[model samples]
Every structure is written in C-alpha cells, then in structure tokens.
Target: MKQETFGRFEVGSCSRSTELQEERELIQNPNLNPGSSSLSSVVNECKKRRPINFCQEEEEERSLKKRRIVQDTTIPEWLVNVMMREEINGYDPKLILAKKLYKSDIDKVQSRLSLPSNQVVTSDFLSEEESRVIYEQSVLKNRTEGLSVVLVDPLLKKHVVDLRKWKMGGNWNYVFVDGWNQVVSTNTFKVGNVYHVWSFRSGGGKLCFALVPPRNSSDSGHGGSSSGLSSR
Candidate 1:
C-alpha cells in the first residue's frame, strides 16, 4: 500500500509539472498575444475588470480626453477563428476579428496604441469588416454621401456629435474621430493600457462617439482619464 501511495504521488508530481510547463509555454507564446510581455496580469484582468463611469468625462483637459486606461487585458478567447500564418490576407494577418465591446465588455477593448498592425483598420474601435458593414448599410444603401459614427452615453441621453472623414494618406487605415487634434495633444497614453471606444447614431445626425475605461482603472490610482482614456 505504501508503494502504491508513493507511485500515486509521483504521478501527481508529473501532472503538476506538465501543467506548469504548459502555462509557461502559453505565457511565452507571442501568437497568443503579440503585444503583451507577460500573461499573468492579463489573465488576472480577464478574471476580473474594474468599473468605469460613462457619462462624466474623466478629465478637464480636452487634450487628454481618451487614451490609455488599464493594462492590455484583452483575452485570446475574445478572438474568433484563430488564423495561422497561412490563413492571412496579406503579409500581415487580414480580416482578424475581435468580439464586440458592449458597454459592459470594456476590459476586452484593446488600445489603438497597442495594435500591432494597421491593415484594414478603422477610425472607430471596430474591425475592418465591421466598419465596412456599417458603411454599406448607412451610406450605400441609404444613398447618402457618407454617414459617420457618433458616440453618446446611455445615461446622458444626448444626441448629435461631429463626425469627420479622415484618409490614411496612400494607405487604407483610418479611424473615425470627433477630436483627433485634441487626442493628439494629450500625450497621456501608455502602450500597455487598454481602452474601450464605441460610436452611436441617433435621431438621424452625424456619427457620434464615446469612450470607456478599463474596469481595473477605478481604484488603481493611475494618472489617467477615468471617463475617456485610450492610447490612440
């Protein structure tokens, strides 16, 4: 019986060692998340996120409106159809899809500053396919010149935001913005911090926009915007 017990202990030790090794491999794997240096913080962020207030703009400085909230906590599970190198569109991965960020899923939102690639990117925090679909429905089908995205807080119940069409020079990457110059002036963005951005169209006005902070930013005492913080 003692020998059997010892054998069981040996098996358990091997199992734990294997599990630890697998986790280490996952943490080191770049494809799991090309931007993150380590996975411990990310895994914890995935396990839990802090809350953010949508209505009140977090900062008085308009320049620092929205950039860099919490650490990059976006999960691999949030991605769809993990593509190998062979399945990409261009030399860069093409048509990579991320799960939509609802008002609640702010933690999963990735920073524009953290994006590793720029092909088929959008002005809003949307994938290329997503922005394209909205464009088709709002502009092409309606026969309008163009319709932009506007973001509003559900609590505020306000309408109408200025929308602009920005070109990516010779390239095809662009995101819609209400305050591009203002965001540029505020150099308050960190590369690892995550931010949530969304747009709304209401009462037949131009595209309006809104921003959300990471769930963890509330009590972390970080020097950043609680209302609108993002690394753009």
Candidate 2:
C-alpha cells in the first residue's frame, strides 16, 4: 500500500513538471503561439513603439507641407512677370506696375512715361562748342518769335532767375527757360527744339517745344504747344 501511494505521488509530480516545461517552451518560441499572453505583451510593446515612430514621421511631413505653403503664398505670378519685363525694359517695372495696378491715376502713369523714349537723333554740324552756339541762337530766335527763354545749366546748380515769379512764357509760342530765369538773348545759342526742364520744387518744371511756323501759314495766333508739362 505504501509503495503504490509513493508511485502515484511521483507520477503526479512528473506530470506537473512536464506541463511546466511545455509552457516554458511555448513561451520561448514566439511562432509556437503568437497569440499567447507573453506574445500579446510583445505585440503591445511593438504597437506602442510603432505609434511613436509614426508620430515623428507625421510631424516631419506636416512641417514640410507648411514650408511649401508659405513659399507658394509669398510670391505672386503677376509680380514675377513684372520683374522679368523689367529686365527686358531696363527699368523697375514692379514699382511702375504697382502704381498702375492699384491706382487708376493718369498723372502717375504719365509721370512714369516721361522717362526718355528710345528715339536717337544725330547732328554732325553740332560739335560740343557749336552746339552751345546753336543753343544760344535758338534762344534769341525764340525771344524774337515771342517765346519765353529760360537757361538751365546742370553744372551751375543755380537758376539764372527765379522761375515762379516770371510770367508763363508768351501764350502764342513755346518758351525757352533756363534753370535760372535768364532768357536767352542772342540768336547764336539754341538748345534743341525739345527741351526737358525739371524744377527743384513741385510746381515749375516742364518739357517745352519751340515752334517755327511754316511760311504762308495762317495759324498766327495758334503756335506750337508743349504736351508733357500740362497736368493730366
């Protein structure tokens, strides 16, 4: 009876040991029971690590998208076109285009247009000294022709006379006025027929034209007129 009881106890102990070994083997090989509690714990840890890595990737993607949006929003297509056109035209078109685009002001547009045109004129008879002589001649002729004369010397930086106090050049003819109010007195000095006059202050400068009437013409009261000086 004692031997049978000991044998039974030993057998039971062996069975329990076998069951524990089987469970340890199953835990060691993840592929054996991938859904086991121990496997489930590993999967949970992997899942946790995946989300952290995914969140970092998502943040990087969002930052890239934000930078792209900012770059696209800052530059407009029209402004780019204006910049390219300016390169071709040799002037800053952006500022000019802006003034026109925003305001329908004709004066502003005309002021910008007054910049030199592309026309070229050549005169072989007018050397630098001869040119001065011709300018003086033109001024005297202008005075006789009832036009006003004003001489402008860029080098002197002084007006021969105060421009404002002088009367507007005669109504019938174009005027020749210098930076100083000095009217050309002789027929020997003449500037070009088209002259550009700029004032130090706001109201006085303009472009003037000297008109020589054709013979046998009846338009005595109506002489040549200057266009750019008049306000828009």
Candidate 3:
C-alpha cells in the first residue's frame, strides 16, 4: 500500500472521502494527540486556545490616539479660553462642529438645533453609555426622545436637551430638541450667524456642549472680533 504524508498526516490506501473525514475529526477533536494530527490541525487548536489578537487591539489604540491629536489641534485659542472660564472649566473640550444658523434652527415651530451629519467634526465623541442610550431610544425603539445632554451656551449657561437622530432627504442628522428653544431664545441667536459647537465631559462625566457664538457677537458678552471657523 502506498502512503502519502502531509505534515504528520498519513493516508495509506484510503478513499478520498475517508481521508477528509479523518482530517475533520482530527481538527474538531481537541483531545487528539498532536503527534497523530496534521500540522494544520495542531495550529488551529493552538489558535482556539488564544483567540484574542493583541496586534488588533494595539492598532485600535493607535487610531484613538490619532483622533485625540486631531481634536486638540483643531480647537481654537478663543474656545480654549471659554472652556477655562471659572463657570465652565470643561474637561478636555473638543470642537465637534460649526455651522451657520438657519431660519429653521431658531424657528419656534421646529424648536431644535439641526446638526447635519456631514458637518460634524467627530462622530465618536459620545461616551459608551450616551451612545447606548441614543441607539436604544432613537434607533431601536424609534422614539422621538433620546439621550439627555447638557448644552452650555457662550454665556456659560447650561440647558438640558434631548439628542436624537432625524432622517431628512435620505440623510440622517443629529438634532438637539425638547429644550433647544430656550437655548436659542436665551442666546438671542439669529439666522445666518455662525456658531462653533464644542463637546466635553462634565466633572460627573455627563455629555455637554459649548455652543460658541461668533467672536464679535455682543450676545456672548465676550469682547472679541467677529471670528468664524474660516481658518479651521
């Protein structure tokens, strides 16, 4: 009888089907001796013992570090000053968005601040709990209400708002509602005015935003020249 060897796997005058069955058994049965099993089967068993890939985890950490670097560089000096204020003193504030206000933003009927998906600076700024709440309420249950977030205006006044995703013209937009009217009214925000939105965690780890007005706006009471996100 002729024997063919494949890295310790020997087939001696056996049918192809038999060979295949034996190979499958050797791979599936963990108790099988490595001396009798094919090299490939032994390797597969070793892989099963340690499923985690440390290389992949290291790569993900590197990616997150890069994102943090980008966020730090993008935040402007004026915004940093706002974050450092006694009333604010935010935790690692990152500029997450900037948009020119539209009529719909301040419209009493809408009563929401629409942040288009494309205009956002970073989508991963939400904490795990915040993301889970938004996903369960907005995506799973299809509820109009979502995660509650604290929004700090340029004046450093905090307003609690509901954050949810809304589909419009086949694209999804993140919107602040159910308290946005207060922010608009309190800030005296006007249409066509540009505003920068910054995100940071509160001391208690709550999601918060700083809605910065145009640098020249008297509404903010921060005496600086008119500045938009043109340079950014």
Candidate 4:
C-alpha cells in the first residue's frame, strides 16, 4: 500500500514538471502554431493588444473631447443625389456632424442648434482664418461675435446664419445662432429628429453646409445604420 501511494505521488510530480517545461518551450518557440495552445494564444493576443490599448488611453487623456474624431466617408447615394445643384454641383460634400435634435434645438427661446465639441466628428470644415477668429474670440472675456455662413436646407433654400463658439458654464459648444430659428420653422424640425450636416465650398469658395434629413420617418437618427448612414 505504501509503495503504491509513493508511485502515485511521483507520477503527479512528473506530470506537473512536464507541464512547466512545455510552457517555457512554448514561450521560447516563435514557430509554434498560435492556436495550438489556449494559454499561449491568449498571451500572444494580449501582447499584440497592449500597445494599441495604451495608445488609445493616452490619446483620450490628452483630448478634452475624450473621444477620437474619425471622418465619415460612406455617405448615402440618395443624400449625394439631392445635394447635386448648380451652386454646389462640382464640390464633393464631406460630413461634418450628425446629431439628433434636442429640445433646445427646436425651442423658440434658445433659437439655435447646439453642436457639442465632444460630439463633433470632423472639424476641418473651418478654414485657417476662420479657425483663428474662433480661437481669438474664445479667449475674450466678453462680446464674442459669430462668423456668418450660408446654410442650405434639404430643399436648397439658403439661410444666412451666424456660427458661434458659445461657452456655457464650463463646457464649450458650437451653435448656429441668429437665423437658426428660421431654419427650424421652415423645415418644421422637431426634437429627436436626426440630421446630417455636410460641408462644401461654393464656386466662389464660400463655406456652405447642406443639411440632410433621415431617409425615412422610421429611420433611426444619430448616424445609425438604420438611417442609411454608418455610425462613427
């Protein structure tokens, strides 16, 4: 009985040692199949992802927006078709932002559409001189003015509007003030409706935007796939 017990203990010890040795070999051997062992596969995957995760975390920390802005390239064909007009015929439209209307957007009192800086996807729509003006105004303690731009609705009606960088409390936001009420009333836009805003240059190099509504009433806003536009 004693001999049999000792024999079992010795076998168990040898099995454990063999496993440890195999683990070391697997780590050292670069030629081994990645899927051969589950443990090694997990380790390899983690090693590959470590740098990517670290970079993303670092970028998020540095940006006040907390999220990276990626340009939306896959615009819908129907939207492109509608934007084909004499004024902006040759210019290719780039998506600037997509958002669902908030209560303040449709409110008569607010009389503006607020575009949060954090939620903005592509901000390169502004020219160097335009960006400089916004930066200069942002630093001022009082009496900041807005830049006038032409905003075209779905029906190709132009609304001359003032785009301003308004700081509310602690957060900074971009707003289409002044003539925004006209846009809301003319289009009959309501809260919770999703719209896509595209930027382009006119023949005379004037900065312009085209606002595209969701493809259908049932379409989900906020740039969802259901709205016929991919989410960033």
TM-score of each: 0.27, 0.20, 0.59, 0.58
**Best by the lDDT measure:** 3
The lDDT values for all models are: 0.33, 0.28, 0.70, 0.64
Model 4 misplaced stretches (Cα beyond 4 Å): 1-72, 90-92, 141-144, 217-232
**Per-residue lDDT of 200 in model 3:** 83
Order of models, best TM-score first: 3, 4, 1, 2
Backbone clashes, candidate 4: 0
lDDT of 1 by residue, 74-94 (tens): 322111111111221111111
lDDT of 4: 0.64
Model 4 lDDT, residue 161, Cα: 84
* After superposition, candidate 1 runs with Cα above 4 Å error: 1-171, 184-187, 219-232
Cα error of candidate 4 at position 114, Å: 0.5
Ranking by lDDT: 3, 4, 1, 2
The runs of at least 3 residues in candidate 2 whose Cα sits more than 4 Å from the true structure, single-residue gaps closed, are 1-31, 49-59, 79-232
Q: What would the TM-score be for candidate 2 when compared with the true structure?
A: 0.20
Candidate 3: deviation at residue 82, Å? 4.2
